[model samples]
Target: MKASELAALIGAELNGEDVEISSFSSIENISEGSLVAILGNKIPEDIYSSSAAAFLAKKGADVPAGKTYLFADDAELALVAAVNALYPKKHRDGVNPAAYVADSAIICENVFVDAFAYIGSRAKIGEGTEIHAGAVIGEDVEIGSGCIVYPNATIYDGCRLKDRVIVHSSAVIGGDGFGYYQKHGRNVKIPHIGSVILENDVEIGSGSCVDRGKFDNTVVGEGTKIDNQVQVAHNVKLGKHNILTGQAAIAGSSTTGDYVMIGARAGVSDHVNICSKVMLAAMAGVMSDIDKPGIYAGIPVTSRKGWMREIAYVRDLPNIVKRIKDLEKDKDA
Candidate 1:
């Protein structure tokens, strides 16, 4: 696409001569006929010197002389738009002969079941949904319209997924939760009888697992995006638009309010409540309820400010101990 055309597509303002862009690339790897976006406040010298054909920059960003520039309110967002326009996702339109769909399964119009995919008995696949090759939809599973279950993803029996949900490769939905009981010096397994409900627009990352409930549904609210390797335990309720980063784990029955952000490697203990807009910093360990919305960090999770202060004081402990010893010697003298 030409610079002016791309700018019009992204609703950006154009400056300098129009240039043809065939692809999108990073600044470091950009070549002629490729476009790149400048994300930082200042345009780097390397980016300015690169042989890129066009640039997507933030409004009011400085442009190199004679270089083509397209200005957007958010350069990163504009990059997403440019990439999508350059390479649109191709969806298969119909079921493949090699797919094993049960006779009782209800597949709606425009749904695509790829080769070797399995749709179980009484399963209902909504319109325009795509079940990629090697994916498995267990018995009685209900998947809504326009969803995509990527290759090798598995949705176990009786789980429900709303519209536009994306289950990345290797994701295990409705898997058994980690529950056990002590019995006569041995561990006994607890049965998870309930299902998982992934609301509209939710995306489960690759290698992530959302466990089924012990007696009721494990519900992930609408617009929530879970990162790779995350674990959502049985009966845990995640509110709308929450972001759980990679390696984060929520223990059984814990509930979080809308717009919560749990950083990477954070752990939330069972039965704890996280209020709306709460931000749990990386590696935070929450053992109790968070009643107020704010940034939290550290084990047993304190406010971010308090945690910083505690860290500072701990760093000065050795000096304080030495001073106390010197004072004792002076008194003795």
Candidate 2:
């Protein structure tokens, strides 16, 4: 595609002569006729010297002399737009013969069910949805329009996933929650009778599990993105646009407000309420409710400022101990 056309599609301002951009490449591997997105404030000297045809750069970044640049307020968003324009995904619209769809299931127009996929009784699949090979949609489940259920994903009974939701391979939605009661010196299983609701535009990563609630719904709000291997326990309510990174776990009944970010390996205890716009640093452990929106870190998480001070104090512990011993020896003399 022409550089001018790509810039127009991505809403970027083009500077310098328009050139043909065949594909995208990384900084180290960029060749002539390819486009590369420059991220952050610093641009490497080698990138300026590279043979790339044009750069997708942020609005205020300094461009090298004579280099073609396509500038946008958000360089990453522009790059994504460019890539989608260059390589649009092709969708196949027919149901495969090997699929096992129940007679009572309702499949809307333009839906694609791949080979070996199973749609249970009374399930409703909306228009433009794609169920990949080996996906199992349980009884009475409702998946909205334009959704994609990747291979081997299992949506247990009664879960409802809204428009444009993406369930990656091996993700298990609406699974029974880990709940038990002590009865006669034995652990008795507590039934998970509720469902899971994934709101519009949520993307659940591969290997992640969202367990069903005890009575009410386990709701994952609109535009939330969950990373791989994350566990969202029963009755957890995640608000819109929240990001749960890899290995993050939220215990049962925990609720997070909109725009909250829980970093990799972070955990929130049961029944904890995390407020809007809160940011939990990687490996943070939340034991109680967070009423204020702020960046928090460390085990038994605290404010970012407090965590930093604690870290500094711990780093100087050895020197402080040595000084204390010297003072004790002087007192003995």
Candidate 3:
């Protein structure tokens, strides 16, 4: 695609020759024929030396000379569009013979079911889906079109995976969550009488567990991508396009806003509400509701800047105490 053509497709303004470009990449690692995305105020001094054929820049950004610039109101959106255009999915045709599909199940055309795959009774598999080897789709599960269930994945009964959903290897969707009660000095288990609802374009990474709700549905909104080893507790409502990094855990009934980013190993307590566009740093433990959008850190999870300052003060505490002791001895002498 030409630079001018990409601008038209992404609703951006072109500022040089309509040169043909094929790929998208970051500024620092821009390949020779790729389109690089640069934020408005993030143009590095070395950007002029980049070998990228074209650039995606925020509107009103300073365009470097001798390079083609495509001005977008939002550079991130332009990058997403360009990547999607350049690397559209390529699906396989027909189901594999090794798949063990139940006779009562309904499978659509052009689907790929790999060896040892099991589709349970009354299950509905939509068109263009690819279920890899060793995957088990439970009874009455409804999987939408263009979805991908990777190897060794398990989808429990009555779960609904909407269009374009991707479940990676070893991910256990619609599993019963950890909900137990104490009764007469003994542990009593609560039966999970609910299911999981994964909306369109959601991706569950390998080894992740998305538990079913207690009485309702545990809903993962469209375009959300959960990373490996993450645990999403029952009844959690995750908004669209939220990014959950590796080992992140969301307790039961917690709700996160759209476009939220939870860093690796961050934990959100039950019943907490994190507002839109908020970012939680790695290992941060959130115990309260975050209604404002900003970067957060710490165990109790305060502002990232405040946490940095607190760390600085703690680092200087020993020196300050030694200096104070010396002054006191001199005064007493």
Say which candidate scores most in lDDT: 2
Question: RMSD in Å for candidate 1, one decimal?
Answer: 1.8
**Per-residue lDDT for 1-333 in model 2, tens only?**
999999999999999889898889887688778899888656678887788889899998877779899999888889999989878899988899999999999999999999999999999999999999999999999999999999999999999999999999999999999999999999999999999999999999999999999989999999999999999999999999999999999999999999999999999999999999999999999999999999999999999999999999999999999999999999999
| Pairs in steric clash, model 1 | none
Model 2 regions lying over 4 Å from their true place: none
lDDT to native, each model:
0.94, 0.96, 0.92
The positional error of residue 157 in candidate 1, measured at the CA in angstroms, is 0.7
* lDDT of residue 306 for candidate 2: 100
Model 3 C-alpha lDDT per residue in residues 108-183, reported as the tens digit of each score:
9988999999999999999999999999999999999999999999999999999999999999999997899999
Worst 10 residues of 2 by lDDT: 40-49
* Candidate 1 weakest ten by summed lDDT: 40-49
Q: Residue pairs in steric clash, candidate 2?
A: none
List, residue by residue over 192-276, the lDDT tens digit for candidate 1: 9999999999999999999999999999999999999999999999999999999999999999999999999999999999999
For model 2 the TM-score comes to 0.96
How would the candidate models be sorted by lDDT, starting from the highest?
2, 1, 3
